[model samples]
Target: MGPRPEYPRPALRRAEWQSLNGEWEFGAGDEPVFDRRIVVPFCPESELSGIGRRAGDVVWYRRWFDAPEAERLHLHFGAVDYRATVWVNDVEVARHEGGHSPFTADVTAAARTAENVLVVRAEDPLSDKTIPRGKQHWTETPEGIFYTATTGVWQSVWLEPLPALHVTRLSLVPDLRAGAVDFEVDPGTDFVVTLDGEVVGRSSGQPRGRLRLERVEPWHPDSPRLYGLEARLGQDRVETYFGLRTVEARDGRFWLNGEPFIQRLVL
Candidate 1:
């Protein structure tokens, strides 16, 4: 089995998707000459990459994949450390900075039906303290607190096929006090709210509204409860789940679900 085979995004899921995590042609520097192979989703500095050594500040990754059939295709990267520049079929698709945040690029225009080439260029300077290198040591060897540094693509990369005019985003804000949940769908499309496979509320031609629950279930650590949600826009459908709960501070104490609760810190 390939590494990290699970779906990259669980909260927002679709039935059709493809995982792009596996071995790829790898090399150090800005040039495209890949002289070695490395397992993707694992930085070259890690043992899992088959090359337990640093690949310098700049590295290149090249891989080929068969394109999926859809009106639109979105290439998603769970994360790439520091900076990343991607090209699909030799056409620049995305350029992103920041190591921890996920990003996506529309590759419908650059993807070919039979096959496509994916190239990634990652830049992560070791001596630069300005970049956010959380827990990563600057020197070659790890010290007391700082650990081994990671460079290049260190997270899952996948492809998802999407329809034209599909739902772009979905936001759910739970209001425990009002026994309802506020929802906002992009492009103002109709949506249906379901709880445990049963329809509870719905809206037509409205993007933002509130859906009151008939029986409220407060989520707790012992007995966690969640509600299933499905939103549809045109031919696109997305499935997600949410839990209802509330936390607040009162009288210098933490309160959970309107009851005073003790807090524990483990940092």
Candidate 2:
């Protein structure tokens, strides 16, 4: 068997979603009141989050969503740093906390047709001195390369269908040599590709097909070009973006943007 590919970020997708990724309550020692706006997928410490102040180890995030007929529901978190506890409609529904990656919780039992309240509490020991602390700075006095810390919901929270018969994943591999992208849908299905609301490419009956597109814009620092795709399954549709580029070794050196250089890790 071949190596399984990495699942796309924001994987638990659905055509219908109430994005609770922006801002919400956040505080430690006491539950937060009122809401603050923060960008999903970016930590509070990041410029994207807007709420630049470092949150303490524990903070709560609360929001509401409405489901029409009360089908099984899935709660998705793009990436919540460290550990987190989740509640739905005032009822404890799920819990997860890790600074990297993503996770999902089945919340079918905790949802109502009207409005569902969600609460999340996150905690991290900053610098445990023992665990792999990544870029998290648990210090009140942030020093050195360490930046601020992000607690609570630092990612998008969305609802996905709890399908009775099917669940699938898709991966698009750009093959410049073939002048196309190898699109393979797990539990494979038909799909289409588009760009700027225009149908640029597509895959037919076969689950795995080549989606060819012209104007091969080599993704680079100077000229970055990307294509969009929308895959269909039953009544569900998903949007994805792909780039055409490659990395190769030349003259015992690494080249990026057709230039010989060493990548710098500022973090």
Candidate 3:
């Protein structure tokens, strides 16, 4: 089995997808002449990679897979430390920065039917403090609060097929006081909002609207009630969930679900 062989995105999920986590050709250079194998989703500095050594500033990863049948295909990376440049079938598809955020590239134009080569080049400077390093130590060894630095692709890589006019983005903003959630669908398409498998609201030729719940269930630490949210736009559908709660700090104590609660914060 491959490492971390699970759906990378849990908040928003689709039924059909493919996991790209497994062994891949790994090397350090500008070219794609890989010299070693590494377990992906795991950084080179970790033991799981089989190459428990620093990956310097630049590293390369190469792999191949058959393209799935769909109108459009998207290549998703949960994250790649620092900067990442992707090439599909030797055609540059995406270039992204920021080590902690996820990115995707539309590979429909560059992908082939039978098989395609995917190459990724990650550039993470070991000593660049200007970039967000978080808890990673800049030195070769760990010291004090700092720990071993992680470089290159350290999260799941996957692919999913979509229609040409599929839903691109969905934003949900929970309003605890109003007992509603304001939603906005990209491209301003007709949509239906469902809560816990029940249709709660519908938008006719409108994209932004509010979905009010008949019964307000304020999420608390003890109860922790969450409402399953499903938004459908034509043939595209996405499944997600949201909790309704509120927090305030004006009372000199923590407030959760409109009640005063003591807070213990740990880092």
Candidate 4:
């Protein structure tokens, strides 16, 4: 009902992720007041955050959650505008600069077993030309081409538990012409690739492998079919999915699935 409640990281996923979306204490100063309740992952400019007003240059947010039992705990933020400084249980954990990319911090040392306090300080000065503002506006009122600024966290924030030596990343490249998909995993461990509960391929203690599909069901706008993918390395496991599709341009024309493509507006 609320944005599907799914793990935001689709490419690399783990089952031990907890969503930090919902209510959080919000304030507009160097020190948090804890008087306002704003929804996480929604900027104050939006109505969903319960504070549908323009945000200050320096804003603060606070959240308290029960720490999950794990050997390692990682706090992930999909995105935060401009610059953000985070603290876990009064210990400075991370400071990230950039508004468009995701960042994570290992909070295993700062978090307590029962409960943990997370604080975020977001600073987005519109006058800072060096920082990328995207479509956010600078003037007091919104105008042409410039939209309302998204100052604070505009994406998902969550915590994930991980083992000591886990599969950190995966790169999947689909080859429609060859009817196979090449993959590479971090840590260079032997991994198995499964599609829709069936084993498609396996790696031999190497970081690379290929999965050959028996039938190629190309993904398109009409039929957005996808295959469930699972990869396991030792005791670490992750689930992801992939869709095979191709697009190219030739002779000053567009092509999809090796055929001529045309755009049709629904409106």
TM-score of each: 0.93, 0.70, 0.93, 0.91
Candidate 2 clashing pairs, residues 3+ apart or interchain: 81-99, 82-97, 82-98, 82-99, 83-97, 84-96, 126-138
Instruction: List candidate 3 stretches off by more than 4 Å.
Output: 190-196
Ranking by lDDT: 1, 3, 4, 2
Cα lDDT for residue 150, model 3? 88
By lDDT, the better pick of 1 and 2 is 1
Model 4 TM-score (2 dp):
0.91
For candidate 4, write residues 1-267 as lDDT tens digits. Answer: 344287799888887888889888998876676678888788998998889987788889998999888888899999998799999989999999988899999999999987688999999887888877677788647899888888888899998988888888888898878777888888777655555567666566668777687667778888886766666777788877778888999999889989898987693
The CA root-mean-square deviation of candidate 2, after full C-alpha superposition on the true structure, stands at 7.1
Q: What would the per-residue lDDT of candidate 3 be over residues 1-267, giving only the tens digit for each residue?
A: 678978889878888898999999999966666999999989999999999989678999999999889999999999999899999989999999999999999999999987799999999887787889888888889899999988999999999998777778778898999988888878666655555567765566557878777767788878887877665666777777788999898758878878898867897
Pairs in clash, predicted candidate 4: none
lDDT tens string, model 1, 42-125? 999999998999988999999999988999999999999889999998999999999999999999999998769999999999
lDDT of 2 by residue, 1-267 (tens): 111112334433455554455455544546555456455545666676666667565655666667645356777777776777778887777666466767777787888887777777777666566645766565766678885655655555666664543336777788765668887786676666665567767676466767777545557756677777776666566777887777778999887646686766683
- For candidate 2, the lDDT comes to 0.64
